[model samples]
Structures are given as structure tokens and as C-alpha cells.
Target: MAGREIVLAEKIDLHLCWEGKQLYLKPIPTFLLHHDFFTHAICTAAAPPGSTTASSDLYASACGFLKSYTKLIRHESDLAIAQEKNLIPASVTWNQWCDFSADIVLNTTGMILSQRYDYGELRLTRLNLLYEMHACEPFHWGDHRYKFLLDTISHEWLLFTFVYFTVVLTAMQAVLATQYGAGSVGIQRAAFGCGVFVLVVAGGSCVLMGVFVWLRAYVLFFSETWIGRQQYRIYYLDRILEALVLSE
Candidate 1:
């Protein structure tokens, strides 16, 4: 099994863009069709129960997609039965029907995003979620958010605490927090550099310290739970020159 060559049967290209809070997926991908998580995501519009913000029209469309896609896929431990009597399409194999179902569901993506926007969600599609996990040095191992949490009781307390922390050469505690960022690394480098140059400053340290503390908290929150607890290790795939969803 180790040496076996696993051909990538599903190849896709995905482009993610952002305008304000809404993450616009240029064209919805079809590879997510087979996954149970994706099915649930679309069906629920990723909305909460009794939430009025969720668009019913979108929810209905999502549900409509599930109705057809989930029709033939039933519970586990069921004996396979011939569908000749049901006149099931010859092209619809077990793994075969996924492409079609994905197409049907993708048509309703606009509605899905509409419902999602109400909740302030849809930050990133499942495909890129895995890369954001800093399992090694940054998010979890370095314990960046530990003392930062304690200093959050009040701003005045934080100001004095930060002053003392910086003088003590304990700045490394915040290295994880300081280096972390959201946008392009180039932008982060500039922002981080500003904090470093003024690290031991007179009054400006307070401002930079505040920014670092905020960053640690941000990384902590996002690593554990993405915006609205929406996605984790998600993936999808699309065609070559096609939309792709990875780890859907």
C-alpha cells in the first residue's frame, strides 16, 4: 500500500476572492458533491435553527438539492438491490452520480451564499482550511495566547503589564502572536516590522502591545473555531480550468 501509485482522479482549480465580508467563489465546484459534510452544509445553508436571517428561498433550494442527491444513498449495512425495476439511469453508478449531483447543487450557490451572509459566515471554502492549521509552532505549540488572556481584564492593567513584559526581554512569548497574520505575508511583514521597531518605545509600545495581544487572541479563536464555527479540514475539487473544492 505504501508504494502504490494513487492517481489523482479528481482534478480541479478553485479561485477564492473577497469583497467586504462575503467570500466570493468565482464558480462553484462539483467535486464536493460526494462528501457527507458538504451535503449537510448546503442543505442547512450552514444556518442555525429558528434563525430568521437565513433565507428560506435559499434554504428551500438547498433542501431541494439534497432531496434528489440523497435519494439513492441510504443508510449503512443495507444490501444492494437491483434498480432495474426503478428504471435508474445506467450512467448513475455509486461514485458515478456524484458529478451530476454536484452540478445540481452548485446551481444554488448564490442562494447558499445569501443565507450564509446573514450569519456573517462563509469566510473560506473548505478547500484551503487545512493550510491554516498551525499545529507546530504558531497556534498551539508556542502557547501564544496563554498570558495574553490573563492581561485582558482591563486596558490600564494591560498597559502596565505590557511595559513590564517588554522590559523583561520576555518578548519571545509573543513571537507567535506577533508573527501571525491574516492577509498576504508581505503585508504582515510590514505590520510586524512596525511593531518590532517600536517594541521598546516610550508610549507607542502600548499601541503595538495591544495589536500583538489582539493577534494572539485572533489566532487562538480562529485556529480552534473558524468564523461562526463553520469549517475545518474541508476540501473540494473541480475540473482543469474548472472550479474546485478540496477537502469538502
Candidate 2:
């Protein structure tokens, strides 16, 4: 019989090796480059025999990729809003919604393209998205407050975006530091920059986490508002109820 081939599917597990120990985690999607996955796949499929290459081909592919990322982000953004509003389950598998979100960072376009070029394309693109998400996700909280304890949280797409970037950057920086001398100026600078990036990321995470915690705790323990005769309803809720009551 001909030798059997093992084909990796869109989903795979991430394994971490430490001190000869292996840790296998949940299933994650392979990197599809969202917008560029098909384009790149086609290009690679039809790639000219190392003979005909054009800058336009690369640029066109990149533009397509960006469009794809935007589309995916928009889709995820909507889903996150829905989830926050308690329209979806908090434990819903990310992969169940978007394969792109479920993909493991290491398997993404950045890794595949890294060796072929001077730099990795997917990773950089991801970082750009991540930076935007990190800076913007917190503001969404103000817009998505629930009427009560069971109300959904909004802007979760932003949270996952941050998580993926954090994981990727941390791994990349650690590898660079370990493989290259940690004391070397280049490594030190890279590490420092990575540190700052991570600090900002961590700060964002903390803010979001804190907001959720506060909202949940406040809803559970405190009366809604003190401005009304009801005396027990939240202030915002009382106002809303009053408006409804008067509208009749």
C-alpha cells in the first residue's frame, strides 16, 4: 500500500513543550488569513515556477486580505454585541461562530509566510487589528449596559482579539529572547518593546474585566436607584419605567 498521508484539518490542538513535558490544549482552527486565505491559496496554487512574480500580485493579495479581515471583524463585532446583550451564551465556542477567531495563532498566515519572506505578513496584520481592538473595545462597555444581572456583555470580539495577540506576541518574544541572547541589545530592545505592548494590552484586559465584575456585583447587591418611591429599583431602571408608565 502507498504510504498514508496525514492531513491537518482547519482545526488543530496547540501543544506546549516545556522541560520535555508536553501540554495539549483545546482544538483551534488553523490560520486561514480570513480575507486572504482563498487568494493566497489560489496564488500559491497557480504560482509561476519561481520565474514570474509581480509586486502587484502581492499588493492585490494584501488588499484582498485586509478586506477579508474587515469583513470578519465586522461579523465578529456584531456577534459580540449580541452576546453581551445576553443574546448568546458566554460559553459559546468561538470556533462555532468564526473559524478565523478559533484559529491558533501559530498556525495562521504569519507563521507560514514568515520563512518565505523577510517578515511575517499575517502576524503584522493581526497586530494592527489587535491594537485597534485594544484601544476601542473598552468604549463599547458604556454602550452595552444591561438592565439587570442577566444582561449580556458587549465587545467580546475585542477581548478575543486582544487574547490572540497577547498569546502570539508573548510566544514570539520569548522565543526570540531565548534563541538570541537575552542580554544582547537587539533582544533587549525587542523585549522592552514587547513588554510595553504587553503592559498596554494587560491594562486593557484589566479594565474590561473590572467593568464586568463591577456591573455584575452592583446588579446583584445594590438597589437600582434611590430617586423614586419604589426605593428598590435602580436609578436608570426607575427612570425608564417611569417613562413607560407615563407614556400610557
Candidate 3:
């Protein structure tokens, strides 16, 4: 087959600010409506005639909107992580925090690289998630509820596994039916098919549920288990940021 140019039709750049911190984004913006872009785009709209910049209020409003947006996102993200944390003992410390941070950063970076390299999409809607992935090095990925809900919505992994196993189960049912003779088996043939289908769906759902639970655990106990491992990484990152700030 011939190759294609592959222009970035869905790409967008966004800037979010809160508590004096700013995060820049270059992500696909297909999900947003024109109204949704109003906050960030207002910076351009508020510019005075013949001027290159907008008024402070526009920027301020953008920041305000960003703060609200961040709150909502973090709230949702924290839900899963919080549930996981609730399961852990209350004696977590600084060493545990560092180790958790290191493990998550390493694992998440690898996952991102692997998925994006193969599938070519990083579809986190909120900028804070990227920051958490890149900057905070959070042990908790997000709320566990979101994992299952989003997977169902996107059918990203769960759907794929379900469909794959469903087909296999159907094939197995058919083979067994043929071996036993569908006519001779009568209603037993239908029951076998139904059972296979039910088992496939049930098993797949259980497995998906287990994966989400594990992800929740990792996020919840990450600080407890891995912060000690991340001491050097945190130190280096802080030093680099300090150097950058000083240079600026």
C-alpha cells in the first residue's frame, strides 16, 4: 500500500494556569466545542485594536477557568486513587512517597511510549493528567471508577478482550455442537451455546475488573511502596528545575 502525509487535523495547543503554576498543552482537540474553547481563546479576543496582546482580565479569566477545570479533573482523578488509598495502612511516609513516585513514573513512561508508538494517540482531556504523568510523578493514576467507566466508553482494552474471547467461545460452541450433533443434542445444543457465551462474557468482565482493581492499588499504595526508590530521581529533578529557574 502507498503511504500518506498524515497531517495533524486534530491537534491544538492550550495553556492552563493555577496557583501561579502553568502547564502547556499540545493535544488533539476534537472533543471540544467552540464554547469550550472560549476560556483560552478569550486571550486573543480581549486584545485591543492594533495590539498584539490581550487585557489582563482575559488572561485572568483564563486562569480562573483553568483552575475550575483543574479542580474538576483532579477531583475525578483522585476518586480512584483515594479508594485505593483507603485500603492501605495509615503509616505511609516520605520514603514510601518517593518510591511510589519513581515506580509510577517509570511504568507510566514505558506504557505511554509503548502505546503511543504503536497506536499513536494520547487522549487525556485534562492537562493536569499529563502534568501528573510528567511532573508530579503521582503514585495514583486516577480514580478507579474512571478506569472502568472510561474503558467501557472507549472500549479501549476491555471491549477488545471481550470481542476477541467472545468469538473464540462461539467457535468452541459450534465445534462442540458439531461433534455431538446439534439435532441429537436438541435443547442441549442451545444451552451449550448460551453457556459458552455467558462464560466468555463473565470471564472477560471479571478479568477487566481485576486489572482496574490492580491499577487502583498501585495508585493508592504507590507512595507507601516506592517513594524510597525515587529519592535520587526527585533530587535530580528538583535540582534541574532549580537550575532552569535560576537561568531564567
Candidate 4:
């Protein structure tokens, strides 16, 4: 009974692990990567290979992952962790290595592809969009307010045109009210109402726009503590953005 309970608990843990990471996508992530579970799994004895070939032959399925890592791996720590010196005891067999690599590459890709628009794809799309807008990495290394303001202000001619049009319209309405209002009260009231409506709409829009900019700016620069600073970043400001993607 005790043995059965222990087995059940482990199976539950394993299920939880896979379930947690069944969706999120990120670079070099794995289910048990860097966890004590990983250490325990590696410490277990690996079954012997079918052939008499050297252990290197076991890595046939994992060669693709190795090639990709060799070419695109950005972090030296990843390489260091996979070294033979660090993988003592039972170490990782070819099966384990393949599983690890699959979890990082294939599983992540599959999850992203299977996800709905508002889920994984949405977050990844957001991340990519932000990546294009960013001048540098880490996503929070610089002040982006100037860039946004300058980018918008670059279209100042349009705003100037709108303002000029509104001013002229208001002036014309004033003329209509003063010159023709007594002759036709309806025309005068219509002109005055039109001018007031336009002003109110335009002014309200400007105020709302300004408020939106101010709020976004505040959010961008928020976070007093070091941990708070990571809230917006560290996986693209989405829930579970860091949940499993931050692993490995």
C-alpha cells in the first residue's frame, strides 16, 4: 500500500508537471529542467542500448536538437549544464536527452500551433510585435516614451490640419450666428449647436487621448522594487507568460 501511494504521488507530480507546461512557449524550456525531479530522474539507471555500439550512438534522435543548439544557443550556461562533468551518476541517456530536447523545441512549437488566438498565439504575437518596436533587447532597457511621442509627432501635419479645420468651422459658425441668426433663428441655433458639438467632441477626444498616454507612461515606468520591475517584462506581460516559459 505504501509503495502504491508513493507511485501514485509521483505520477500525480509528473502529470501536474506536464499539465502546467502543456501550453506555454519559450526558449530552451523543459518540464523538469533544473528541477530536483531532473536530478532524481538522471540518477536512476538507464537501460542498456540494443546494439553494442558506443553510447554516442544513442544520440541519433537528439542530433537535430544538438545542431540547433550549437548554432543558435545564446547562453553559455546551457552548454555548461549539459557537460559530461556535470551529468554525473547515471547521467542522461540518449532517450532522456531526446526527451529533453523534444520538450524544448517540438513540444513548445506544437503547443503554440495548437493554441487558440487569445491564448498562446496572442502572447507570442504580442512579443513579436514588441520585439520589432524595441531598439534593443530585455524589452525594458530604455525609455520608449520619446520614441512613441516622436513617432506620433512626426504626423503633426495631420493634427495641424484638423485644428485649422475646426478653427475655420467655428469662425464660419460664428459668422452664420451673428450675420443670419436674427433672420433665421433655426439656422443660427443649428450653427451654434454644430460648433459647440464639434468643440466638445474634439476636446473630449484630446483629453481622453492625453489621459491614455499618461496612463500607459505610468505603467511603463512603474515598479519600485526589483521584483516589481519584472512584472511587465519576463515573458511579455501575459499570464503564464513566465509560468513555464521561464523554466530551463
- The candidate that achieves the highest TM-score relative to the unseen native structure: 4
Q: Rank the candidates by TM-score, best first.
A: 4, 3, 2, 1
Where does candidate 2 have its weakest 10-residue lDDT segment? 11-20
Q: Backbone collision count in every prediction?
A: 10, 10, 13, 0
lDDT of candidate 4 over 75-119, digit per residue (tens): 444344334223212344545555555555642232212112212
Per-residue lDDT of model 2, residues 1-248, tens digit only:
22222222222111111111222111222333344764565445333333343434444343333333333334656557435644345554456656534443212332222122222122322332343346422221222234322233445776787788778677767776574556578767776787788779789877977787685556433432322335545666879999999999
Q: Which residue runs does candidate 2 get wrong by more than 4 Å?
A: 1-152, 177-183, 208-228, 231-248
Candidate 1: lDDT over CA atoms? 0.41
- Name the candidate, 2 or 4, with the larger lDDT value: 2
Model 2 steric clash pairs: 84-152, 84-153, 85-152, 86-152, 224-233, 224-234, 224-235, 225-233, 225-234, 225-235
**Candidate 1: Cα lDDT at 11:** 16
User: Where does model 4 exceed 4 Å of error?
Assistant: 1-144, 149-171, 174-182, 223-248
Query: How much lDDT does each candidate structure score?
Result: 0.41, 0.43, 0.43, 0.41
| Cα RMSD for candidates in order | 21.7, 21.9, 19.9, 18.4
TM-score of 2: 0.26
Enumerate residue pairs that collide in model 4: none
